[model samples]
Target: MTTGHPFMQAHPHQPLSIAAKILSPQMIQTIRKLPEFHLQAWKILDRWAFNSPEMLAQLEAQGEIVLMSRLLDQQAVEHQALMDSTHQLQNGMTEHEILEMCEIHTEL
Candidate 1:
Protein backbone atom coordinates (compact mmCIF):
# COMPACT_ATOMS: atom_id res chain seq x y z
CA MET A 1 0.00 0.00 0.00
CA THR A 2 1.07 3.57 -0.62
CA THR A 3 2.09 6.05 2.05
CA GLY A 4 -0.84 7.62 3.90
CA HIS A 5 -2.98 4.54 3.23
CA PRO A 6 -5.67 4.27 5.89
CA PHE A 7 -4.39 0.87 6.97
CA MET A 8 -0.93 2.36 7.50
CA GLN A 9 -2.04 4.63 10.31
CA ALA A 10 0.40 4.45 13.19
CA HIS A 11 -2.28 4.74 15.90
CA PRO A 12 -5.71 3.10 16.08
CA HIS A 13 -7.39 6.26 17.36
CA GLN A 14 -5.90 8.72 14.85
CA PRO A 15 -8.24 11.43 13.67
CA LEU A 16 -10.29 10.96 10.50
CA SER A 17 -8.63 14.05 9.00
CA ILE A 18 -5.37 12.11 9.05
CA ALA A 19 -6.94 9.26 7.05
CA ALA A 20 -8.44 11.77 4.64
CA LYS A 21 -4.88 12.73 3.73
CA ILE A 22 -4.80 9.72 1.36
CA LEU A 23 -6.53 11.65 -1.41
CA SER A 24 -3.60 12.03 -3.75
CA PRO A 25 -3.80 13.79 -7.11
CA GLN A 26 -3.88 10.48 -8.98
CA MET A 27 -6.71 9.19 -6.82
CA ILE A 28 -8.65 12.37 -7.46
CA GLN A 29 -8.14 11.95 -11.22
CA THR A 30 -9.21 8.32 -11.07
CA ILE A 31 -12.34 9.32 -9.22
CA ARG A 32 -13.12 12.07 -11.76
CA LYS A 33 -12.62 9.77 -14.77
CA LEU A 34 -14.68 6.78 -13.59
CA PRO A 35 -16.51 5.17 -16.57
CA GLU A 36 -20.16 5.86 -16.04
CA PHE A 37 -22.03 6.26 -19.34
CA HIS A 38 -25.73 6.51 -18.69
CA LEU A 39 -26.91 10.07 -18.12
CA GLN A 40 -30.36 8.87 -16.99
CA ALA A 41 -28.86 6.29 -14.64
CA TRP A 42 -29.50 7.10 -10.99
CA LYS A 43 -26.12 5.90 -9.72
CA ILE A 44 -24.05 8.21 -7.57
CA LEU A 45 -20.31 8.39 -8.11
CA ASP A 46 -19.78 7.82 -4.41
CA ARG A 47 -21.50 4.44 -4.77
CA TRP A 48 -19.90 3.49 -8.13
CA ALA A 49 -16.85 1.90 -6.50
CA PHE A 50 -19.14 -0.49 -4.63
CA ASN A 51 -20.95 -1.48 -7.84
CA SER A 52 -17.79 -2.41 -9.79
CA PRO A 53 -16.67 -5.93 -8.97
CA GLU A 54 -12.95 -5.26 -9.44
CA MET A 55 -13.12 -2.13 -7.36
CA LEU A 56 -15.30 -3.90 -4.81
CA ALA A 57 -12.77 -6.74 -4.61
CA GLN A 58 -9.96 -4.31 -3.96
CA LEU A 59 -12.02 -2.51 -1.34
CA GLU A 60 -13.07 -5.79 0.27
CA ALA A 61 -9.51 -7.06 0.41
CA GLN A 62 -8.36 -3.83 1.99
CA GLY A 63 -11.32 -3.97 4.35
CA GLU A 64 -10.36 -7.49 5.41
CA ILE A 65 -6.79 -6.44 5.99
CA VAL A 66 -7.93 -3.51 8.10
CA LEU A 67 -10.32 -5.71 10.06
CA MET A 68 -7.66 -8.30 10.83
CA SER A 69 -5.23 -5.61 11.85
CA ARG A 70 -7.81 -4.05 14.17
CA LEU A 71 -8.74 -7.43 15.62
CA LEU A 72 -5.15 -8.14 16.57
CA ASP A 73 -4.77 -4.62 17.89
CA GLN A 74 -7.84 -5.12 20.11
CA GLN A 75 -6.48 -8.41 21.49
CA ALA A 76 -3.27 -6.69 22.46
CA VAL A 77 -5.26 -4.03 24.26
CA GLU A 78 -7.39 -6.60 26.05
CA HIS A 79 -4.38 -8.62 27.12
CA GLN A 80 -2.71 -5.52 28.48
CA ALA A 81 -5.87 -4.64 30.37
CA LEU A 82 -6.01 -8.11 31.90
CA MET A 83 -2.38 -7.89 32.94
CA ASP A 84 -2.94 -4.48 34.50
CA SER A 85 -5.99 -5.76 36.35
CA THR A 86 -4.05 -8.74 37.65
CA HIS A 87 -1.30 -6.47 38.94
CA GLN A 88 -3.82 -4.27 40.74
CA LEU A 89 -5.71 -7.22 42.23
CA GLN A 90 -2.56 -8.51 44.09
CA ASN A 91 -4.10 -11.99 43.78
CA GLY A 92 -4.60 -13.51 40.35
CA MET A 93 -6.80 -16.25 38.87
CA THR A 94 -6.05 -19.97 39.14
CA GLU A 95 -4.03 -21.76 36.45
CA HIS A 96 -7.18 -23.38 35.07
CA GLU A 97 -8.87 -20.03 34.60
CA ILE A 98 -5.82 -18.62 32.80
CA LEU A 99 -5.73 -21.65 30.48
CA GLU A 100 -9.44 -21.32 29.73
CA MET A 101 -9.06 -17.61 28.93
CA CYS A 102 -6.13 -18.37 26.64
CA GLU A 103 -8.16 -20.99 24.81
CA ILE A 104 -11.09 -18.61 24.36
CA HIS A 105 -8.83 -15.83 23.13
CA THR A 106 -7.22 -18.07 20.53
CA GLU A 107 -10.61 -19.28 19.30
CA LEU A 108 -11.59 -15.67 18.70
Candidate 2:
Protein backbone atom coordinates (compact mmCIF):
# COMPACT_ATOMS: atom_id res chain seq x y z
CA MET A 1 0.00 0.00 0.00
CA THR A 2 1.12 3.52 -0.63
CA THR A 3 2.34 5.31 2.50
CA GLY A 4 0.27 8.41 1.76
CA HIS A 5 -3.21 7.07 1.08
CA PRO A 6 -5.57 8.69 3.57
CA PHE A 7 -7.65 5.60 4.17
CA MET A 8 -4.57 3.47 4.78
CA GLN A 9 -3.18 6.08 7.13
CA ALA A 10 -6.40 6.37 9.08
CA HIS A 11 -5.97 2.89 10.55
CA PRO A 12 -2.95 1.04 9.28
CA HIS A 13 -3.89 -2.04 11.22
CA GLN A 14 -7.47 -2.00 9.88
CA PRO A 15 -7.61 -0.15 6.59
CA LEU A 16 -10.94 -1.68 5.66
CA SER A 17 -12.32 -0.17 8.85
CA ILE A 18 -11.62 3.22 7.34
CA ALA A 19 -13.24 2.04 4.12
CA ALA A 20 -16.46 1.38 6.05
CA LYS A 21 -16.23 4.70 7.81
CA ILE A 22 -15.75 6.62 4.57
CA LEU A 23 -18.92 5.16 3.08
CA SER A 24 -21.95 7.40 2.65
CA PRO A 25 -24.73 7.34 5.25
CA GLN A 26 -27.05 5.81 2.68
CA MET A 27 -24.60 2.99 2.12
CA ILE A 28 -24.25 2.36 5.85
CA GLN A 29 -28.02 2.31 6.26
CA THR A 30 -28.34 -0.09 3.33
CA ILE A 31 -25.79 -2.35 4.94
CA ARG A 32 -27.75 -2.30 8.18
CA LYS A 33 -30.89 -3.27 6.29
CA LEU A 34 -29.24 -6.25 4.58
CA PRO A 35 -30.92 -9.65 4.88
CA GLU A 36 -30.04 -12.03 7.72
CA PHE A 37 -27.69 -14.20 5.69
CA HIS A 38 -25.91 -11.17 4.29
CA LEU A 39 -25.65 -9.73 7.79
CA GLN A 40 -23.88 -12.94 8.81
CA ALA A 41 -21.42 -12.40 5.99
CA TRP A 42 -20.80 -8.92 7.29
CA LYS A 43 -20.07 -10.40 10.69
CA ILE A 44 -17.45 -12.64 9.14
CA LEU A 45 -15.96 -9.64 7.34
CA ASP A 46 -15.94 -7.63 10.54
CA ARG A 47 -13.83 -10.30 12.21
CA TRP A 48 -11.29 -10.33 9.38
CA ALA A 49 -7.92 -8.66 9.70
CA PHE A 50 -5.24 -7.81 7.18
CA ASN A 51 -3.54 -11.11 7.79
CA SER A 52 -6.63 -13.26 7.91
CA PRO A 53 -6.86 -16.10 5.42
CA GLU A 54 -9.75 -14.60 3.48
CA MET A 55 -8.11 -11.23 3.36
CA LEU A 56 -4.86 -12.82 2.29
CA ALA A 57 -6.63 -14.69 -0.47
CA GLN A 58 -8.14 -11.49 -1.78
CA LEU A 59 -4.78 -9.78 -1.47
CA GLU A 60 -3.09 -12.45 -3.52
CA ALA A 61 -5.74 -12.45 -6.21
CA GLN A 62 -6.27 -8.72 -6.79
CA GLY A 63 -4.70 -6.82 -3.89
CA GLU A 64 -6.70 -6.06 -0.76
CA ILE A 65 -7.54 -2.42 -1.56
CA VAL A 66 -8.89 -3.25 -5.01
CA LEU A 67 -10.99 -6.07 -3.60
CA MET A 68 -12.46 -3.85 -0.90
CA SER A 69 -13.13 -1.08 -3.42
CA ARG A 70 -14.92 -3.46 -5.78
CA LEU A 71 -17.04 -4.83 -2.94
CA LEU A 72 -18.08 -1.32 -1.96
CA ASP A 73 -18.79 -0.41 -5.57
CA GLN A 74 -20.96 -3.49 -5.99
CA GLN A 75 -22.86 -2.69 -2.83
CA ALA A 76 -23.47 0.87 -3.96
CA VAL A 77 -24.79 -0.35 -7.30
CA GLU A 78 -27.15 -2.81 -5.62
CA HIS A 79 -28.36 -0.21 -3.14
CA GLN A 80 -29.02 2.34 -5.86
CA ALA A 81 -30.90 -0.22 -7.91
CA LEU A 82 -33.10 -1.10 -4.93
CA MET A 83 -33.85 2.53 -4.16
CA ASP A 84 -34.59 3.37 -7.79
CA SER A 85 -36.92 0.42 -8.15
CA THR A 86 -38.77 1.41 -5.00
CA HIS A 87 -39.10 5.00 -6.16
CA GLN A 88 -40.38 3.94 -9.56
CA LEU A 89 -42.97 1.64 -8.02
CA GLN A 90 -44.13 4.24 -5.53
CA ASN A 91 -44.48 6.88 -8.23
CA GLY A 92 -46.12 4.57 -10.76
CA MET A 93 -43.46 5.42 -13.28
CA THR A 94 -44.24 4.74 -16.94
CA GLU A 95 -42.60 1.78 -18.60
CA HIS A 96 -40.51 3.95 -20.95
CA GLU A 97 -39.17 6.14 -18.13
CA ILE A 98 -38.49 3.11 -15.97
CA LEU A 99 -36.48 1.54 -18.75
CA GLU A 100 -34.51 4.77 -19.19
CA MET A 101 -33.82 4.91 -15.47
CA CYS A 102 -32.63 1.34 -15.54
CA GLU A 103 -30.16 2.19 -18.28
CA ILE A 104 -28.99 5.26 -16.37
CA HIS A 105 -28.39 3.16 -13.27
CA THR A 106 -26.16 0.60 -14.90
CA GLU A 107 -23.25 -0.43 -12.71
CA LEU A 108 -19.74 0.82 -13.42
The ten-residue window of minimal lDDT in model 1 covers 37-46
Clashes of each: 0, 0
Best by TM-score: 2
What tens digits encode model 1's per-residue C-alpha lDDT throughout 22-85? 3234433433344432211111112223234354334434754453343345445445545645
RMSD (CA, Å), each prediction: 16.7, 16.3
| Residue pairs in collision within model 2 | none
Which residue pairs in candidate 1 have backbone atoms (N, alpha carbon, C) closer than 3 angstroms, thus clashing? none
User: lDDT for each of the candidates?
Assistant: 0.35, 0.41
Give the residue spans of candidate 1 off by over 4 A.
1-62, 87-108
Relative to the true structure, candidate 2 has a C-alpha RMSD (angstroms) of: 16.3
